[model samples]
Target: MTTLRLSVLDQTPVGEDHTPDQALRASVDLARAAEDLGYTRYWAAEHHGSPGFASSAPEILAGALLAHTSRMRIGTGGVLLPRYEPAKVAEVFGVLASLYPGRVDLGIGRAGGPARDFPRRLADLRALLGEGGAVPHAPVPPQMWLLGAGRESARLAGLVGTEFAFGHFFSPVGGREAFEDYRERFRNATGRPAGGALAVRVVTADSAGRAEELARGLLLWRARKDLGEDAPLPSYETTRRHRWTGAELARAEVHRTALVSGAPEQVHAALTALAASHGVDELIVNTLTADPADRRRSYELLADAFALPPGGPETTVAHAARVPASVPAGR
Candidate 1:
């Protein structure tokens, strides 16, 4: 069997009563659990000024994850490179690498939304990484990654000699053709003998019925965003309050590509087929289940279905300080 590394993109809820500290604690627990479950990485996303998705401060959260787990790699699913000065980002991640050593990853993206002034954001990032800046004493100057929806990001990643991860979960062209184009362009642009490896996000579940239920929850959230309902993100309870017409459901189906839901055997078959067909190097799993327990259970089932080995012994010496709760078995 082709080896598949499991990782999580944590978008768990931080209830209104919970402070950032508590929310971060919860995320730490989740990361530790993922590590114990033999996941290769725990990547958090960057979202500024959004509700429900409480991982806005990826740098701080990444530190917490690093402190809690010894082996699993920690990364930003993406830091909006366009949002901050590249020097500031370098400093932040530089500190992260210094503290955690080889466990840090920096995935940069071009998106920062329209509300923020784009031109100024771009200029800031350039200044930070361009030249004559205090370089972080990194072994290889950090493992940089570029994330985007199209070929431009792939080209940039190649030019910069960093990994390129395409946003298949949220982008419009998150299909086989897109992956093919990225791999081809990366090979040509970099002139590297080894083909470019790509990572994509997927939402998976134990059974088709449950998968559909979970997908409806995700689809509802996306639809609401498109509708411009700008309030704190709705709870799954609130998300379920809204309903979709048949046509709307069809649209959700079309948009929800790469999400696999079926019986355990069926899900495994589907994922394996996808890996072989696309030459994907990594599959990043994003669970959108409303309940935290349900979400955790989804990951457990997926790990078992994929026949992943249990995580090796925790590297306590490498990460002796600020260890979080020990992850429960069968995480």
Candidate 2:
């Protein structure tokens, strides 16, 4: 069996009736909770011009997360490399890596608003980090994780000799083959064994009906966004009031696969299949909901469902503190 480790990829969603600041606070609080729950890594993603998301700068949010938690890994779920300067990115992560050391990571992707020279950008980033001239802390570079969904990204990351972080949330059709191709390319081009992680969205509740209800809100929000509706995500009650149009319904149908939800058994089964299918070393989860309590509960439920190690005995510590633990630790 492939050993599976769980991590987080937060979008800092602005839930219904909440402001962006509250969303950011929830992310920080959730990071603390994630640490207490023994999640290996907690990554924040960068999303621009989205009323529902507050994480425009994952690097800064990652720094905040590092300040709040003592041990969990923090990084960008990832940074759009083509959209930013490689030198600046190097400097940003260099400062973070020096401050946080092994706990910092940089997951970069060439997608959605990008140029064609991704491999070149990666090389430039590495080169900038190695120069030791512009950055005071250039000696300590953060771990690089290339984020992508298919073979081209796999191949690019392989050529650049960085780890791959595959996002299968929006696209999972050829996940297995893409991962396989990445491994093959890594071995052939880099002549080294490389580890890869998977990213996907998951929704869970106490029962199937409740989980579906949670799904309806997120699905409807995404459906609206896809149709160029820029308004913030509405409450589930409000969403329930809107009658669906045929065009919107069509978009919703395509987005249904992006949602994974159910009771514990069903959620675990789905996650296990996803892990087994890609043979991923880590499964990074993204859960966005109208309620932070519900979101936190979902993660707690997932932690139980996966039987993930209690990083320490103090697993009961909530979002605000990191108390000492009494149980056996997980890897």
Candidate 3:
């Protein structure tokens, strides 16, 4: 078995009663804690016009996360490719790489939907970031990754020579085959070793029962999302109080299988098996809970379960460097 490497993919979810600002702050807190707990990378998600999610600008969020964490690599879980020009995306991440040097990544995707021209845009972005690409003016190029759910994206990532990340959390079907196709077709003209990561939804607690309880919001949220109900994540109480129809319950059940929730030991075993099946060493955890505390706790438990080596003592922040009260704590 390949040694497991864990990372985070935060969507900055806003709960029913929470504000987007609060959710952003929680993301920073989680990134810092995740770094101290030995997570290898922290990738912020981009969601457009969704009150349920707050991180519409992952590049900006990535900058904040990079400032807060000392060791972990920071990047966009993806900046939706079709929404912006490739040159602009390259330039943005170029500036980020200039600031953070080797600790920045540029993960691009199609905004969680199908796009006919994604492959071309992806190639264009890759060329601009390549050796003779548009980012030559910057100090260094950020690591590039293509985020996809199926074989087509996998093949594109391979042909274009960027790292491939599979969205197992949302598209669990054919994930194993996707990975196989990626590895077989990978061709890096730049000569970087072929790399891949699998992203999955996970929830963990001290007990299996508690984990299940914490995941109630996610099941409800998934069901709601499937039915075109675009609202903030529901609280545990909200999920419990809401009535569930048969179709909604069935939809939730279908999504439940994609979530790996249990005690740390149980979760670890499941994740390990999943990574093995996908033939990937890296696993990106995307935990969405109504309570931010539960989301934070989930990462802490996974880090310990995976035995990831924690970072050394945190460097002291000068008094003058402390964030002012007027500013959000996460910023």
Candidate 4:
């Protein structure tokens, strides 16, 4: 059987008035919980000027998560490469690798930086990796990965000598095609053996009914975000009030192509079939449930269904030292 790796994108409520410190602490706890559940990696995302997804500083968050866990590999689902100087990113990730040793990964994304600022950011990043830079006391050059929604990202990943990870779950191309495009380009670009791999994220649930119900909220939020609506803590009820039409619903459904929702045996069969058909090297499962308890349950259910052998620390609910009082539960 193909090995399945469970990973999480720690997202915080955007509209809520939570302090950054509180948000960081909560994210750390979540990562630790995922580690105890025998997850392979824990990742955070980069979002700017967005209230609904507050994890903008993935490097700092990666460091914190790394400090809190001993086994699980910590990384960014994607760092917005267009936003920061590549050198700074390299420096930051290098420091993290130094600190965490063999456990650091740097996942880069083409999104994040504003279009107006992209040129400068791209230039700086290139310069940093190109020439003279101060070496660290303990160098931690990260194993880089490129995350993109299209072919350009796949090509870039090949050029950069890093692993390619496509956002198949949220991208327009869906999973199988995206995986194929990435793998083909990776092989062509590097002229290396087909050993280099691709990783795709998906949302899987125990049942179609439950998955649909859970996906309703997630889909609605994504639709609203795509439309550039910035209401705070927007819920499914609010989305229903807006009345999404058939065309909009169809578009949303298209984006949901990678999602697998069924009974345990059914889900396992579907995922295994998907893996074989696509020649996917790694399957990164991203569950949609927001409630921490529900999220944990989802992980357990998946583990049982896949028959994943368990070998990790037991799950423990650590007392969050600084819970943000103003966090809006964006369920």
Among all candidates shown, the one with the greatest lDDT? 3
Q: In candidate 1, which residue ranges exceed 4 Å CA deviation? A: 12-23, 113-135, 172-191, 194-201, 204-206, 230-242, 245-251, 312-331
Could you give candidate 1's per-residue lDDT for residues 1-331 as a string of tens digits? Answer: 5576556776545443345555567778778878878776777888766555677878778887888888887878778776676678877876777677767777777787552454344334433433324366443234556666676555444444446666656663543565566556545644553233344444456677766666666666555555654333335566567767666566667667745665567767776776667566466677655455556677788788776667822442242211111211110
Q: What local lDDT score does residue 23 receive in model 3, on the 0 to 100 scale?
A: 97
User: What's the lDDT for residue 15 in model 2?
Assistant: 76
How far residue 276's Cα lies from its native spot in candidate 1, in Å, is 2.2
- Per-prediction TM-score to the true structure, in the order listed: 0.78, 0.90, 0.90, 0.75
Residue 53 lDDT (model 1):
67
| Shift in Å, residue 288, candidate 1 | 1.5
Report clash pairs, candidate 3. Answer: none
- Each candidate: RMSD to true structure? 8.2, 7.4, 8.2, 9.3
**Model 2 error, position 29 (Å):** 0.3
**Predicted candidate 3 versus true structure: per-residue lDDT over 1-331, tens digit per residue:** 4568898999999998899999999999999998889887889999888878999999999999988876678899898999888888877877787777767878888764458777767766666666346654345567778898999888767665567899998888899888777776663333335669999999998889889887878888888888989899999888779899898899999998889999999999999999888888889999998779989988888888888878621221110111011211110
Model 3 quality (TM-score) = 0.90
Please write out the lDDT profile of model 2 over residues 54-144, one tens digit for every residue: 9999999999998998877788988988888888898888888777766787888786564457667777776665555338553446667
Window of ten residues with lowest summed lDDT in model 2: 322-331
Off by over 4 Å in 3: 112-114, 132-136, 187-193, 312-331
Evaluated against the true structure, the overall lDDT of model 1 is 0.61
Query: Per-residue lDDT tens digits of candidate 4, residues 1-331?
Result: 5465445555544323345555556677777777767666677888777656657788888988888898777788778877666677867866776777657767767775564564355334433433325244223345556676666665554544456666656552454565566666556655553322334333445676665655665566566656676534434345446677676577567656656665556667776776666566455665544344444556667667765545342321111111111222111
Residue 190 CA displacement from its true place in model 3, Å = 6.8
The CA lDDT at 306 in model 2 is 83
> Which portions of model 2 miss their true places by more than 4 Å?
112-114, 130-134, 138-140, 312-331
User: Model 4, 172: alpha-carbon shift in Å?
Assistant: 5.2
- In Å, residue 105's CA in model 3 sits off its true spot by 0.6
